[model samples]
Target: MSEENKTYTQEQVDKLVQSETDKIRTEYTKQIKELQEKLPPEKDEKEVDLANRLKALEEREKMMDVQDELSKKGFDRELADFIKSGSDIEKLTEILKNNQNYIPDKHKGTETTITKEQFKAMGYSERAKIYNENPELYKKLSQ
Candidate 1:
C-alpha cells in the first residue's frame, strides 16, 4: 500500500479509461439524437438553392420590366431601380411623368418602316433613289 510500491497493469488502466470515454460518448450521442428529433426537418440543399435562384430571376425580370416601361415613357433607364422597388404602378408612372430624366424619343411615333403596299405605290426611280441614298432603310422597310 506504500507509495511507489503499487503497480497496475497497463491493460487494466487502458480498460478503465476506455470505459469512461465510452460512457461520455454514449451520453453525448443520446443528447444529440434527442435534440435533433425535437428540431424540424432540414430542407434539402437543392430545394433551397432553387428557391433562391427563382427569387433572383423574378427580381431581375421585375427590374427589366421597370426599365422597359421607363424607356417607353422617355424616362432615363437609370431610374429603373427606383421604379422597380415601388409597389404602386400609378405612383411610379406619375413620378416618371414628372421626372427631369424624361426626354421624348423623337423617333417614337415616326414610322421608320413602310408596308409592301406603300413600297409598290412608289415609282421605280423614287425607290432607286431611296435605295441608293440609304440602303439600310430600304432593308428595314423590306423586313
Candidate 2:
C-alpha cells in the first residue's frame, strides 16, 4: 500500500503508543534514579529537630553540672558560664588553681569594721566578697 494510504489497525496503533509510553517512562525513571544517587540522603525533619534539641539539652545539663562543681569548690557559680571544660571537675579545679590570681580571694585578711553607709556604698562584688569572708559582719552591716 502507498505510505499515504497506509493506516494502522486499532491493535497496531495501541501497541505503538504503548511502546512509546514505555520508553518515555523508562527514561524518566532512570533520570530520577540518577538524580537521587547524586544527592545526599535527606534526614527526616522531625528527627533532625529532635537531635538538635537533645544536643542543646545535653549542653545545658553539662553547664549546670559544671556550675554546681564550681559552687562546691568555693568558686562563683557565674564562673561556670566562662568555663569551657564541659563537666570535667578536675580540669576546672586545675584551671581555677592556675588562674587563682585573677579570681578574687573568698577569704582575705581579717575583716575590718565598716559602717552601714560604707557597706551600702560598696559595689556588688565588694559586698559579695565581704559576705563570703564574714556572713555575720555582712548581716550586721546590712541590718
Candidate 3:
C-alpha cells in the first residue's frame, strides 16, 4: 500500500530508483575520468584531492548496485553527496555499505555509505574551521 495519491506503483518506483541510481553512478564515473585527466602526477595536493574524490565516487557506484530496500523512504541526495566526500576511498566505501534503513549486500564486512544529510547530521563543521586555521593552504586548495 502506498501513500494517498502516490502515482508510482512498486514496480514503477523500483524502476525510477534504479534510473536515478544509474544516473548518479554514470555521473560519478564521468567525474572520475575528468579528475584523472586533471591530476598532476607530480603529486600536487589539490590534484591528489581531486583524484581521491574521484576514487571515492567510483566506489560509491556499488551502492547503486545494491537492492534498495528503502525505496519507501526514497534515496537521500544529501547523504549520497556526503558519502562521496570521504577522504580515503576504502573508508568511504566501508561506511556506505553499512548504513541503516537501507538493505545490506550479500558481501559481509562491508562499508556503509554516508549521505550529505547524514554527514550534516553527524555535524562536520570542520571545513570552515580548517580553512580559518590555515588560510594559505585553504587559498591554495581553493585555487
Pairs of residues clashing in candidate 2: none
TM-score of each: 0.38, 0.42, 0.25
Candidate No. with top TM-score: 2
- Against the unseen true structure, what C-alpha lDDT does each candidate score? 0.80, 0.87, 0.60
Worst 10 residues of 3 by lDDT: 64-73
Identify the runs in model 3 with alpha carbons over 4 angstroms from their true place: 1-4, 41-143
**Model 3 / residue 123 / CA error / Å:** 99
Error of 2 at 88 (Å): 8.9
The sequence of per-residue lDDT tens digits that candidate 2 reaches over residues 19-132 is: 999999999999999999999988899989999999999999988888887788888888877886645667877887898788357656646668899999999999999999
lDDT for each residue of candidate 3 in 1-143, tens digit (9 for 90 to 100): 56875687799999999999999999999999999999876878998999999998877664443323222234444444333332334464456667745855664653654344443454337546546775664455444
Query: lDDT: which candidate is best?
Result: 2
The lDDT, on a scale of 0 to 1, for candidate 3 is: 0.60
**True lDDT of residue 47, candidate 3:** 86
What local lDDT score does residue 101 receive in model 2, on the 0 to 100 scale?
Answer: 82
